[model samples]
Target: MSKLEIDFCGVKFRNPTVLASGVLGVTASSLKNVVKNGAGGVTTKSIWLKEHAGHKSPVMFGTDHYFMNAVGLSDAGIEKAEKETFPEYSKGGRPAPIIANIVAGKIADFGKLAERVSKLDPDIIEVNISCPNVEDELGKPFACSVVDAAAVTKLVRSKTKKPVIVKLSPNVSNIGEIAKACAGAGADGFCAINTVGPGMAIDINLRKSILSNRVGGLSGPAIKPVAVRCVYDIYKATGLPIIGTGGILTGEDAIEMMMAGARLVGMGTMVYYREVEGFGKVVSEMEEWCRKNGVKNVEEIVACIS
Candidate 1:
């Protein structure tokens, strides 16, 4: 068996590096390209029930320390997934596992999106109740309230037989409590520490907020500490598998996340820092680290810190 190979929620992954949702838009060809570049799996961008016109352009900007965006979860909806994305992805026998990420503005809509996306039969279903950009319209993310998070989890769980992994937010006070609620409601696993903050940046010269949306979630190398802490907390709270994400830019960062109890490392902003080939690069780096440490399996490091 490969040192990096892992079974997450009954699904086998060639490696633990997965393309986080929202980096590259959901296109079958683009996703396939990422896999070819060496990602063990790919997650679709947040899929709404109907086409969503996200915030107008100027939605993103970045620096060496951080990346921020207020893209607002725009998507072409489930119709596109059923008719175009999934069909095209399956055309070539699917190079890697696909995690279908479904989102909605309402709890009921969550169930509807789950049901429809599940029928398309992606390898796993990620329920995105934590997008921070749309708080103005949606009135705060569902991940903030344990009761509401559980509600969404229960509804989505009932709608699909596929593994249901809830994407969590880092903006909360006690992420572990929220995670426990979801676990009780039947969540199969979790993707912890979504972008941190609905933060903003101002162009000193322009004298105004950078993004058109004014505020956005923070990503890139800056948030790795927060990601590690959240992953550690969630693991201690539930011992469920986690996809640790946020500010992961190197293979060492991936190994650090695994030591915090993440079964897989989710990366999005790394694409911005290292390009698509970063996946293979990080995987190779991980292997080298393992060999140097005399570790036989990558899984051996999971939660080793505690």
Candidate 2:
């Protein structure tokens, strides 16, 4: 009722609430449930050129206010998703626009994966160079460097006609520079900031780290401020449409990201906490707040902070 539609880089969503990759998107049924519950869009779990078994068990450790995960981009691969998952979701009456989240260790892998998934006709393809749990020679993830980020993004863009959104890593010295490079490399948009840290939690009595990987990426409310800063910086640098993610747990949190310059806000840990219907609840609350404040459309509030 509040005209919640948001258009970004020629792609439009019924609203700004999207299910972030790796939360409820591991399978077709799970993704369909999120859409049925009112997700404006859904980003499938980050897929790779080849299937990965992912990290071991105890991959997730919970903190009082957030979560740390080392899921390691475990996916069924692009070919399987195109053959199995996408067909089911596409046939669902309530299916939301889908964005295929893809990751790879090499530039050629990124291009091949993007080209393959682009045929599935997803609304967008998010190149995931930002996964923090993996090991890379650059010391940080590939998304941390402007050169690597641009290389992956440009390669993918060259192979696909679908809009490409480069998901940026927060574990970087100059996020704005990387963002600018991605935009210049023909990226249609950006999704910031993937997990705030390769943080760790330890069991002092057991003398062991809580997560199997020992270091995991932090998500949820604890990382919200960091995500806001990344979105703000990138917004200032490139003016690209951003899918803000990280620590969104409520409608107010989503609004904060949008006001900080995100065209769409992704909800991950919140959905893990609230389940499928959580998306509708958040959207309803946002609508109420907008109506009472005499807001016309959500986009009018982007970067409204002063």
Candidate 3:
């Protein structure tokens, strides 16, 4: 195996850098482009059981330090994914594994999406129960409650034979407790600390909110500290591997995340900063760091923090 290779819940990744859900994840060509540019794996945008329209344009904005978005989990549904995305991704022989990220407004819908997407057979299925932008339509996120989180986990787990990783939120009081609850309900693994804060930003000139939805989740360099903490807590609580996400923009940031107990690091806004080629750039930087630090296997750094 290459030094950068990792086995996350039985799925092998060429490297630990994966395309975070909702970036350029809408189509097969975009996801494959991410792999071609050196991402270890790709996750599709949140797929619903049926078509779901997202927020209007002006859904996102970014600054040097952070990005705020309220895309509202837009997706064309699983049928389109099965008919176009999965088949097209497979047509190219799948340079890297695909993780289908599914979201729903209710528990039963989560199960249905899970069952349907399972048939398409993406290498992994990520249960997105923690999105912060859909609260107006769906009430609070499932990740906010231990019982609800576990319920979603149990239902999704029953629906799919594939490894199920529950995406988590950072807005909770004790993220560890929630992680433990999901683990008890049969979650194979987790992707910790999705975006943070359903915060708002104003357009000073327009004297109005920037996002059409008024507020959105905060990501980019600002939330890395929270993501690291959440990953550490989840790892300590369950000893389960996590895909550490939020605010990672460089190789050093990825290493810090692994040291905080992530088996893989997911990047979203980094794409905005460095483009697709940033994946390869991050990987090269990681190799250089390992070489200079006398680290042989990159996995050796996973949870090295104590």
Flag regions of model 1 displaced more than 4 Å.
Answer: none
Listed per model in order, the count of residue pairs whose N, CA or C atoms clash below 3 Å is: 1, 0, 0
lDDT of 1 by residue, 126-172 (tens): 99999999998899899999999999999999999999999999999
Worst ten-residue run, lDDT, model 2? 133-142
Backbone clash pairs for candidate 1 read 220-247
RMSD to the hidden true structure, all candidates: 1.0, 1.5, 1.0
User: What TM-score, computed on C-alpha atoms, does each candidate reach?
Assistant: 0.98, 0.96, 0.98
Higher-TM-score candidate among 1 and 2? 1
lDDT tens readout by residue for model 3, 28-73: 9999999999999999999998999999868998899899999998
Q: What is the C-alpha lDDT of each candidate?
A: 0.92, 0.86, 0.93
lDDT of 1: 0.92
